[model samples]
Target chain A: MPLFLRGVALPFNKGQAPDADVLAVSATGPVYIPLAKEEADAPTLCVEENSTVAAGQVLCHVDRLPVFSTIAGKFIGTTMVNHPLYGSLLCAVIKPTRSKRVETLPPVEEPDTDTIIEAAAQACIYDELDGIPLADKLRLWRMAENDQAALRSILVADATENDIYGSSAWCILKEQAQEALYGLQMAARALRFSRYHITTMLPRNRRRALKRLIGRENVFTTGDEYPVTVYDDSRDDVFCIGIQACAALSAALQQGQKHTHTILTVAGDGVPASRNVRVPFGMDLEEVLQACGADPEATVILGDAMTGVPCQNTHFPLLPGITTVLVMQSHAVRTPQPCIGCGRCATVCHAGLLPYEIVRRLENMHYERLRYLSTTSCDGCGACSYVCPAGRDVATQVLNANETRGTIFLNWGGVENE
Target chain B: MNNITAPHIRTEAASRHLTRDVLLTTLPLCIFSAVTYGVRPVLIVLFSILSAIVSECVCCLFRRQSMQVIRDGSAAVTGALIGLVMSPMVDYWVPMLGAAFAIIVVKAPFGGYGRNVFNPAAAGIAVLSYCFPQRMFTYPIASSMNPLPTGMSVGDEVVTSLSLAAQLRADATPSITRMQLILGDFAGPIGATATLLLVACAVYLICRGTISCWTVVPYFATCALVAWLFPAAGVSRMYGVLAQVCAGYVLFTGVFLINDTVTTPRFWFARLLYGVSAGVLVMLLQRIGRVECGCCFAILLLNSIAPIMDRWSWYVWRYVTRFLRIRQEVKAHE
Candidate 1:
């Protein structure tokens, strides 16, 4: 493949308060915690309806993975709730009580690899972006130690915020650099990888703070490009975990805390000011919007502008792995016109695939030709759609081709192909 | 509330905006043509634009497409291109005929706008040149042309001039000075002349990102290379290259036709190859073809091979890399 620089530099619009201190929003009302993991089979519920449960109490289990409650309250009857990434899921609602009932795993001092892995499993820690349970990921990396793969494995803490209006990851790295790096080092030690790096898109001065915390060489900076952090490097041996997940892992091992609270960047034009806010999982979207002083009439997106899921209403609960909550006014939808063949889409495609050509083949149902064009190489960054003069969803069309072919292509390799 | 897909935001430059930019870039050429060849060329351009819009509307009605299709302004650009390629001395109806053929035959029949395989403007100009060779090739002397309103048809009082391409084909040294050719003081097509203005417009378009420099640079380089390697009789190699580049619709074709987004290859390497091949073909056609200018034919031919070029260029790169890798493995083993 031609080694052209792929990915577009997205404009930063973190609104008026990108550098503002993070606000902590406690759940004032009932929080609905989804029982099943995103895209996974339904988990078995272990709690009874109307029973009192302490915070960090185990509520459900998907095989070996445990799902914990984020609030100490009465366990209400289960109900179907709309999940931002996953569709409607059965959730157990917990109304916060004044009682300070809490449950947490015992903290381990200078924990070894087995102790860290057990603590991660008990704490229900997950990689914030990939939605994969961290304990299982550790097991897989540990297994890979015996494999004779030529590429050396490395651990990476991805602090690069790919969202156009996201600053949560950056804020986490800025405030919790010590804990994040410590967590990364712990994971690397557990995986038997000597090299670990932290990647961020922060400006030089801010990056200097991170570089100071974890020696200058350990912190690598990338441009403010969308999907830059997501691009799979030529060597596929690198294991990536979100910066927030690193912080959570650190908290779980050091403070004996549960991975419950998530830091999210609440931004867009509809809010009075954009700020990073830490809210517990299962909090209502309405409460988050109100905490951010957002306009209720504006459209609420669960993620950033590009590749975000638009919420139909504010009734849905905030789910894990959500880095941004954009409250912006709805723009007038333009009627899509015929493709003028401007090639603007091709210019912004980071995968080096001609999106317009793939779109043409898709329109003609040329499935074999689409394969020849490496349709699966598309990571669906949505840059092609953003730059298309014709308002065509070129990225979505390639994604549809992938769906039709039953291929689960990620960056370079697919689950089926493997 | 709009339930749009992932990208809720879009860039400001839509298809209409691009078309407007293109039209804006051609304004300097139009103004220069009006000053040199009088108001007749401007009138031809306006008439051609009107004819194209009308033809597009008719085609839309017949094809049951929305009237909003014309709002993209592609037909206007096509019409302007068709008029610019015609001689300033042709009858007013000649441009109208060319515009109609461009829209109805070349553009709309292939599902309109971006779907057309061949560039409508180049195809239209080619058809006009084929059917009306006398009107298309003949040009009035720029110095003798009336500045004010005159008869639409070629008047007997005006003196005619031979184009530089025809002179080169006839194996005669150009009577015009090098400065005159650079300044476009001699007779040629309406907009293809004004060599300095065309160069300025090309630069502006490239800087504004309305056209790709990948295609434009390689095309001119190849044309200059070919012309220098085989200079015309009685002319120096450098002058031959300059004359070939500035005269006979060469610069105009490079600026507008070959760099067209719809007909050209999308990949950079394919686009580079397309430009070089187009330059070579235009030179060959100018040397032996019956027409005074062969740019339109070359563009049409290049347009047909663009998809194949896009596919093969990728395969070639892949094979070359694979070959290099295998050779490196052998070297390391040895």
Candidate 2:
């Protein structure tokens, strides 16, 4: 049996927004503001680059994230109401004052060492050294050393005041005092490597676009302004119908748009300054990694974390719906080895259907579950793909599901409310 | 100190992904079926697969769920398995119905694919036995042999072979050669002919890492052993093990049915358990129940208990290892 399952559950129908009406926040483009002082779900990715957004665009993706854009240009600014748990945090209304151009904000690498250290300190907390054993921690605190792992720990402590015990930090063990000093130094160096200011993206015609993407009935418009459209391909339709669908990735790209939001993650042991960068569409992937101080010889670019769309070029266009171009220093981990049939692929499926069963169905051509299993419901989160010990390309199964869906939907196209 | 902590390396044969491998392994059987039953039977089997595919697909639609993966090869495999056993002209609906039940209820509901605990073919046959027993058991038609009876009672002793027919008519056993039976020149189900062919396919399955030979060999051996030892509790021990091995579709069931992954044990020992028990059951059922079609029962019973047998084997192995270790420690002290 596979380890993961494409888990399935009936959609929570009550108060659940229709599939067509919901608008999700793109971190690169949308800024999530709040409505009247209530704790909200995450804000919608409303307002395109130059277009002014209105107040009624419903900002949300399925069940995750808050709704409400903060900019009141042509639309109402999103805000949070009262909440018992995050009562104080609800009243926070952050304005979208940052300019869209790349040259507007100061570069992250240009920040001073003290400011970097201070920012790290605010985000991280250090552990007290009194309780640690001498044999374990003695090598770290005693020296000004150049060991990368020890240096990393010291910098982590100086920046965030945390202890690095059993982790990848042990890879660079060396002289003691130097390790601590080097750790702090490395943290400051890492902090100085950020290339640009990261921001959430909001489509210009948020409500109209959302309505078009989700369809008008799917969008549940409460008292708040929702970015929506009616879904018939129209200029007034806020949604951008994807030009071409990549079955491998579950998301469709927004057509006729110059830039779109994509997931960004920096990986690789050789990269000392790895960070997440949400780059614009058509931006070179290699350039983003280079900006984050990535070592190319030791890198392997994975298009999506779930299913890596590997390209030799670092400068592949940043396509919308492609999660991240993950660069792993250890490329030896991925190999087309045999699956042990452990069923790990079946365990992590959010769809509630076992992956092994799905695979078996695919193999047997059972077509029963294959036709009715709702291949469209899959979000391709890759939880099932990640836990596989054999490291099979589980997302490929999603692709298979897509291919199978084409035939089934066509065959049964006239059956009912397809 | 077994050093069995983590990173256990396996051959990595994917259960669900092994469809191509399995098809490769079972290819020879398909060839044999085509050759023995000719184009008509093969087409019937194909139609059966198409029917299974259609039936399961319809079920998925009724459930309002997508059963898209059902078209890959599972429904086809189920159809082929049923096709191999059908009489070729035995109403296309029968095998299709059987395949549908096997995939949806037995295979899909239990989590489809690797999650099924029974051999899909075995389960389908079992259900088919209950639903359309006559259709499932009616003998196949052959060109080399004479035509079948126009109408006969379901349980009547209608000989499947012309030689058997002649012998029964003449009140004496006819001269049916062992070589002919082994080579599958005689009339039988679409899947029954080419006994050697099924064996060849079985060998490929074992070699390609898609099958476990341990279960198949022992399963045949045990059946042969029991058949030779107990030929009806004092009835003349006329037929021997080799005779029984080559008789009817025993070889077909041994190679294909007994080795179904989901129905048999994953562990080698549990497989032996399944085989031995099935062998005993087949003989017992054949002798006591006086049923000619004992292979279906034997296989289905074993399929039902395969997971249990696996658990039992695991339990026994665990205890046996612990017991031996205790004995070794006592000897060291002494």
Candidate 3:
């Protein structure tokens, strides 16, 4: 095993190893799908209120990207909901009706590069892990490869599941290994990449099972650290995609289906046992928690425990790209304290940035020195805050410094003078 | 609902837990000192702790801070450290005044607890040593068992003697056995004399990760190197190394004051350099300086320059990496 100099060895929460079967969770009430994707232009609504709409029908358009609905129902008036990525987004509320009508794109049997890209765009397949549309990522990769002929691209299916409490990627890879690998191979062949690999943090038995499906040489097992999959596009020639995205792509191209459901890992102290469930888009978060045997009154977070965003309103509808739901007791969260300068924060930082020093400089308003500290390298993994004895929010301080500087120091694979 | 940041979970050891661990490690040393000096050291330590708490409480109230700041137990640690470094023959007022000074002058004004740039205990002991050099350097015989209520008067001829630090400054070979040195049977500061117990405490703190070995190991190694290269007038090289390590506040400061989280450098490389330079400074002060509290002064001096050292170390790392990268590119082209 290669030694990772940074990152903390967080304790894996007990009973977090979800079962291989993905339980299907349907909406018990009206589902709300956000109209706008994160960082995209404001979407213009196309459907009217109370209009009969089928599942997999486009309801709005943000720039050239289309937003699809997963529920076959009537389009009630739009309501404001707290979006997981973009705060306070206008969502189209759809009341479920007794219609079985659904719309899907034509399956491409012999998909080339353009056909796959067009299929991805039509199916509304977004890489939830990378927070980018699949079609755009494909186009960008093709453009880069074409620009530099010597730069060989590698497609990496990132199944590392770097979070301490979630196993959505692991469960998906275990149950649908063939589909995930086939999706990766299809993308690599279309993009004309040199090779493709699947990286996971699974144990020996699970990894061996995956190795059996895809040849053993194609799988790479990384260290089970909190943040082993930080992607740097400027420096790396590798094109990374989440494992669930690959599975979605395969479903879109092979089964002639739209990307509608997401695999979510529901696990925390509030639940009796952790389970991986296939939650359809626009499902209520409260309904998903109740179905997973979690208390509705408990504090609900919409991602993994380390980097998850806490849900302010449990009534908020589930959105795509949200992989984990951490339902923790409200009392389990402790109040932050002042820094004691133990240096444990610096020791556990995966980016090797001095979090305490950054905090000190920020407090003193020493903005000039922060650039030299390389605050932009911080990936906000929360490892520093996890290991801090003082309970100080050192990770947030470093991230805020990154924002204040407003400059990302990209490593372009060359030496730069200080 | 609590809308906290990410990392909803945290490690178990908080600042209070770390302070409790440090206090627990000092218990053995305190007990050993009590047994050696017949309750005099115990009274001094308790009084010092009491005064430090009272002083911090007053400072907090005056500054309009919350009373919860006192619950961290850092004040008591500083007090215990001050008491440990003092001569057991001194009156209760000595330790009481030192603890008050440590908390009020060195700690609270700079912002209590984690924000203090200089270590309160070291600064307190250094101030006391400067004010009362005659009373501070004098030590009663080890295991004297004289628990007299009144403080020992200056120029009293009842078994009072020069401490090992003073003897070394006067250029005389210490008339002590290796066993006595190891077991702390010689006349020195109350808690600092127990070389064996202090070593065990250092090991425990290092194991618990409450203290860094990067600071402690390099400190002792540099001191040993200096002592080996230049032995005292009458002692052999090996004897000088052992005597210098076991004498005065060398081991005590290495285990406690220099390893203090707030005053020391944050990065490991800077800490390594701090330890090495502190060792050299301590040795130089012991050989040439007039004061007997050489370790305390050495720690204070290093604490002042710690931030600069941290910044310099970063620059050095950057330059070295850039140089190596350029060399690599040149080799690749060739």
Candidate 4:
């Protein structure tokens, strides 16, 4: 039996991601290919300052991986953009030549591992498995293959949504079950992994539907927990991927299609309808919101409500990694209250770390004590912050401790030794 | 743009909502006390709540914080609890001072609201009990013809009144019957005396997810077990447990004060241990000396050790799981 992990049952409105229709937003404005903000060194640009480019053409290269444009456009220029993972980066701007034109490459015959990997790299398929390029994933898989005994199993986390209002992944699996299944098969066959697990927290009805698509023996139901969005983290060898990414892989292998379009679930109280729409990559979020009839005053968040980062600039392009866009009425920002020692944070912590104690240690700069407590175990799930009655930003504090643990220790400079 | 952290939204019940729910949950006890004692209790409650709110506002002004912090309803809860724990016979200034002290001194000085290490109301009651023992200990007796209004002054109409704790400590046989003690006919704290009503409100609070059963059940169980095993004044185990629980603020403190979200442990096992320790301490303090409202003092003492309880709970949980793993391995080998 698959064990049910310790997590708090959250009471929020659960809405299925709209999967019935795919509404495409026309690419009217300039498209931006944002470079990773963490890199101190600027990425090498493939196209020069005033070059015209076709859709699916390489705009730049970061760490030797190509960054492709989703629309046929003229190389307008570079502009500073607030990158999601990092703070800010210079984005290569491309003004779309045509709204509907999507460039494609010839599909390789007899789709093999290397061919698929190369096509994925050329097509700019970013797999969220490690939040790395597909090419990197292929390299990692190849390295893992050298020592097959080290491989435990592969976990396909088909648990469609991370938050109460999330359901896009479920919708994708429901609509394109065959493609997703084939993609999973191809991944397993390529890696030559015998043991694999498919997990979902979908209701019985949807589970039944998914079972028909991916055999019942492969499916294991999980409880309704927020942290289950990330598969069981205990098994370090388990290579987990979203069902949509799996389907995208199969599509890239079978058809000669590049990763040009992405399906986004625009839901919450701010929009007129909760929709699952197929939008071309590099299309502005504002255009998608206008199409969805989102409220002008509503706050637009790029991802689920629980752990989604608030979009400071909605004018930014929606990339392939962008999945859920929540447009909801802005609630009053709760001033962080004093820690009540309620222990609710500890209870809801999926990482099993005492968030309150760890945060206290972090705030006081007690690096050694935090290390003793294993503060780095935190998965940055934000479950602790979500359940805190005192409205403390618990996950952020824990995340700070994990990220800054090394810097703090280095800065200590043998003070304790004295 | 409201550029907050990753969690764009929060749990529906914020600290304000929770405090409001706690205030609402105490309604039944308030109503029962008003009917049984009189309007004096209500006035005392009103005065305390008003003073607490004013003191909080004043503190907010002094601290240069947004006056909006008072809107979280914590000061109101502190005020209401202070009033409930006061004797109706005492002057109105007693509750007013208690509420102000609870908020401005015990709560605000420690850093407002959730930062306070002690239960504000309990601390207020403790200070009052120490300073004005005579006034704080006095209570109005209810008669058959006219149950004296709770807020009314102590006069000839309320002639014969005995403080339950004083009477219990004096001798084995109490002036009031066990049933009367259960029904709260004698002089005691306004809300604390209403045993049945307080219990009902506690159940309601637990059901509403405002409080946890882990805190209450283990605390009560521990109290009952201790009182039963070591009877007070040669009384039977059951009767002794009833006397200990009913005479003082044991149940009321267990349900509200110890379970105060700001001061208690969060883990279920830690909470259980916290409850057990608090119950044991309450009984130990009661046996040692004449501490008026021993449970309140016990709670304050135990609140300081809550983090320790949490740490120990973590260690024990790891050990237990490890032991279970070893046992399973041994079984498989056999």
Q: Which of the two candidates, 2 or 4, achieves a greater lDDT against the reference?
A: 4
RMSD over all Cα atoms, model 1: 4.4
- Chain A of candidate 3 scores what in TM-score? 0.88
* Candidate 2 vs 4: which has more TM-score: 4
lDDT of each: 0.82, 0.46, 0.81, 0.75
Q: What is the fnat of candidate 2?
A: 0.00
**lDDT, candidate 3, A24-63, per-residue tens:** 8877689888875442444667898899999998898766
lDDT of 3 at B19: 81
Candidate 1 chain B weakest ten by summed lDDT: B143-152
Write candidate 3's Cα lDDT for B1-334 as tens digits. 5458888888898888878877887888889888877777887888899999999999999999998888899999999999888787887788889999999999999989988989999999999989988777778888655643445332364477788878777889889988898989999887889999999999998899888888899999999999898888888888778888888688888899898888898777788899999999999988887787788899999989998887778668656666876776566445
Q: What's the residue-level lDDT of B80 in candidate 3?
A: 92
lDDT (Cα, tens digit) per residue for candidate 2, span A284-305: 4556666667777654544423
On lDDT, the leading prediction is 1
On DockQ, who's better, 3 or 4? 3
Alpha-carbon deviation at B20 in model 4, angstroms: 2.0
Give the RMSD in angstroms, all C-alphas superposed, for model 3: 5.4
lDDT of model 2, residue B315: 57
Per-model chain A TM: 0.89, 0.34, 0.88, 0.85
Count of clashing residue pairs in every prediction:
0, 126, 0, 11
Tens digits of per-residue lDDT for model 4, B35-72 = 87667777788889999999999999999999988888
**TM-score, B chain, candidate 3?**
0.94
TM-score, per-candidate, Cα-based: 0.91, 0.44, 0.88, 0.82
Q: lDDT tens string, model 4, A117-145?
A: 77777777776433456656655665344
Worst 10 residues of 2 chain B by lDDT: B1-10
Rate residue B214 of model 1 by lDDT: 81
Every model: iRMSD:
1.5, 12.5, 1.2, 2.0
